[model samples]
Target: MDLPRAFTIRESSHRVCNPFTTEKLALLGRAISPSPGTRMLDLACGKGEMLCTWARDHGVSGTGVDISTVFLSAARARAAELGVADRIGFVHGGAAGYVADDPVGIAACVGATWIGSGMPGTVELLRRSLAPGGMMLVGEPYWRREPPDQATVEACHAERKDDFLPLPELLRRFGELGCDVVEMVLADQDSWDRYVAAQWLNIRRWLDANPDDELAAEMRAELAASPVKYATYEREYLGWGVFVLMNH
Candidate 1:
């Protein structure tokens, strides 16, 4: 029901649980520019950065649902820190089957689409809570370039080459699903580095402070291999973006 301690540890410093920088995330908010008092529901909303920041910047209000108590705590703290505590709420719960009782202006599942099994299922789940003319925000990875072999796929943390599509095909998928791709903000290599490289520092710092912790050995091994693996495979082959969609 919760994210593993290892994952929480690795992403301890992340404001958003994906490969997006604060600047880029703000860009998305500005790009969409939701009106004041817009209501939103964000599923699997790790740390609630988007809700808090958007509330502060765009005057929106929302509820965020997440499985991780740790993340929810951070999210609450962030809401307070951003002076949007009254504008946003965070709930600790399963996101897969959760839907807002009332339709919302925005429905989102960013970087945790597995909560709804995959893209199609996640879109359906989000749709349940969307108001007419409302938008959906989906964060996903696509292939920047086709991985040449199974080893490359595994290195990119995918089990199969087909796990992600190229950008054009992904846009086509949105069309097939009866949504229009209105706007998108993509993650570049630098943003990916910031997101992934921060994990190494967090791991090393945690290991330094808690040498005997049970997960230390595994994290240590990951830290050793992740840098090169990321540079070679994921950085070269994987692309991540948050797409804004409206029903067609």
Candidate 2:
């Protein structure tokens, strides 16, 4: 019912929990420009950054759901800190198959499409909770450059080359699913660095604090190898972005 401790530990300091930086996220909010008081439903809404900030900056209200109790607690605290606690709610639950009781103006599943199996199914699931003419925001990764071989794909943490499509193909996918790509905010290398490199620091800090913890050794090994792997493979080959869509 909760995210693994290792994942929580690694991303302990993350706000968005994806490759998006605060600036990039703000850019996304501005790009989409959801109107004041718009209703949003965010699935796998890690730490509720989008909901909290959008509540504060855009006057939108929403509910967020995540499997991580730790993240949900952080999300609640963040909501309170931003003085938007009254505007947003965070629930502890699985996101998959969890449709909202009421349709919303915006339905989002960012960087966790596996909840619905993949992109197509995830879009379908989001649509179930979307009001007519409402928008959907999906954060996903696509290939920045084609991986040269199997080792490269594995290094990017993809099991197979087809696990992600190229960016153009991904947009085409939205068309195939009966949606129009209205807007998008993409992550650059710096955004990737801020997200992934920040995890290394969080992991290192945790390892130093708990040298004898059961996961310390694993964290240490990951810290030692992650930088090079990221620079060589992921930074060059993987791209991530949040796309806004509406059914045509």
Question: Per-residue lDDT of 1-248 in model 1, one digit per residue for the tens?
Answer: 78899989999999978999999999999999999999999999999999999999999999999999999999999999989999899989999999998999999999988988889899999999999999999999999998999999998878888888999999999999999999999999999999999999999999999899999899899989999998999999999999999999
Model 2 TM-score, all chains together: 0.99
Poorest 10 consecutive residues by lDDT, candidate 2: 151-160
- Output the lDDT of residue 184, model 1: 99
For each of the candidates, give the backbone clash count.
0, 0
lDDT of each residue in 73-185, candidate 2, tens digit only: 99999999999999899889999998999999999999999999998999999999999999999999999999999999999878999999999999999999999999999
What is the alpha-carbon lDDT of model 2 when measured against the actual structure? 0.94
How high is each candidate's TM-score?
A: 0.98, 0.99
